[model samples]
Target: MTTSFQKKTRSKVLQIPGAKPSIYNNQLLISTGIPSLDHILGGGVAVGTILLIEEDTYGNYARLMLKYFCAEAVMTGHSLLLASADADPEQILKELPAPIIDDPGKGEATLEEPSHDSSSDNMKIAWRYRHLPKFQSNTSGVKFGHYYDLSKTMESELTQTVDISTVDSSLCACDSKQTDGEFNNPGYNSLLKTIQEKIMANGFSTTTQVEKRNILRLALHSIGSPMWGEKGGLTENEMYSPALPRFLVGLKAILRTAYACCVITVPAHLFCDKAYVRRLERLTDTVVEVDSFVGSDKEKNPVYKDYHGLFNIKQLPCLNSLVCNMPDSLDLAFKLRRKKLTIEKLHLPPDLSETANRSQEDPLKNLKPSSGCGTGGRSNKLEF
Candidate 1:
């Protein structure tokens, strides 16, 4: 006799929008908030995977993706942002996209109010059809998400734990234990250690109470820069510095045990040797490079004119067996708009609008062709 799994199965949900996999899978996937990107990453990145976005040019594009990831996480109530970049953590958090609001003004659709009258409950289904019941799901699952504002300052509770660079000795094992259960604005290794502590504390709560699981969205911008004092000119602080590998190793271990995901953008070329960068890649699950590999020349193509940068997904996320919920493949395109940054599948652009065709008054189209050497004037074909 086979038992049915109807009642025991819970909805596979990420804590917020553009995060988490599905409503009924054993594996957990978080949506990246960018619809196209989330679709590509098999239903958002797996929790605990470190996404490394390497810089191709000035590194501005990489920074934008990092910001988008953080903004989405924030919008969905995953507010535990751990920024390890040289930039101001507060500024980064403050620059996330504004929360999407459902406006009921100007005759727009508003949420329906629930009816509390007892008379409505009395109208029940006939007993003849009781064996086949319909599933009525609640649409309020997204309500638990928090709204974030880019223009305003974050509240005290919406936290940011920034761990910029510092000498490894400054935060040795002795001082780390004394960090008072908080790794706020500490050194490199300290941040990883703190994250590990949080992961261990949560244990496996993610697997059981999946919906209520709060994920950590860590944005470590520019791991090696002069501001942090890691760069020492002409040697990448003499082979991967003293703190980077240790930090990455500890962070990877924590991710394996935690209910969190990380997006760390780094210019490994400037800071680490080839082998060092490989080690970082080995530790990470996804690696993306943002550059003009597809030709950023605006004069040649219209797509280049619209798109700001080219993206290459060097690595795909590691997911468990669940084919229906995952994407077919991961081919992506990126566009940076005045207000938004989008990453979508590389596709042919839609044809120009009819209005645009009417707007363009072509001077050459209506002009008659002048008589030329091989044209209507005369056939100048002489046998030689």
Candidate 2:
């Protein structure tokens, strides 16, 4: 659309490391690991961004997305994941799709066979005989990330850890000398401190090695749930508690500096307050709401018989960030089928077949009436 298209040099957007960027708005996309979803996002999510997904009224599909997001990180070489939901680390590992060794029809090519031209011994310091560049005739199969099987995650299946930091503890150890005020800061939670330290250690720098930088995919499921130390409702004593807000703000700050992106799902319906939801929405880079078609008759439905739930983008990412410039309003619905999970554009049900049948029979009825009439038809109203 612009002169950038004619430029001979390739943009960073065109050469994202692990996967192919979205074809729509290929600025700086982070593959979501879902094909239809990546297309919906105009390639994928933008790096240095936070996506807050509100669970459906039924609280069904959001968890699936959270699991897939984590699984994708594991597949795309971003193995260090910070999961803060009811699911345990083992359960999370199990949810990740297997490496594509057995299937050649689709998925990533993980097991690339070694060439037979290597020497039996190590080559010593020799003359100036350089190897040729690899010949690439086909560029069709670019795997962005892996997929996951349908999983049943349970609260009891895995023991959820509160102090969840998926990095080395020694790297983030506190200093020997520190003031009481510094130790007692509102953002001084153990989890937050550890993540902030890790971000600083791996953050992008002019002198730092970009190839070695670690990308962390953080997933926070139901943040206000019991796992994160929530005390009942958001009124009275609970209203004054600043634990969740402080942690989220600190995490946001951390993401901005590090090679990371986050997908968080919160049970917004439980709060039952517009102010709290809006406040949470304000803190995130993007916000989406999901809901089920509880009242609609599934038997009569046509367009979305395969759909599981509906989704809507509430707030778009701000223009100042590295994220893609996505369309403000988007309509989407998702469905789960066997090993496949899909999201598609939401649409109204198709027209009824009975209407078409009625149209076909009406002409026959009209002809019979005219044939049975005498010389002139005596009409109740004016003849047309």
Q: What is the C-alpha lDDT of each candidate?
A: 0.55, 0.57
Worst 10 residues of 2 by lDDT: 154-163
Q: How do the residues 93-158 of candidate 1 rate in per-residue lDDT, one tens digit apiece? A: 656565445521212113222232233455486545444433221112243222333354444344
- Which candidate tops TM-score? 2
Candidate 2 lDDT over 225-245, as tens digits, reads: 544444322423345344455
- Can you tell me which runs of candidate 1 are displaced by over 4 Å? 1-19, 22-25, 102-186, 198-212, 232-243, 269-275, 292-303, 321-331, 347-384
Model 1: worst 10 consecutive residues (lDDT sum) = 103-112
Candidate 1: clashing pairs of residues: 11-23, 12-22, 12-23, 12-24, 18-31, 19-31, 20-29, 20-30, 20-31, 30-44
lDDT comparing candidate 2 with the true structure: 0.57
Error of 1 at 186 (Å): 9.4
CA RMSD (A), model 1: 13.3
In candidate 2, residue 159 scores what lDDT? 22
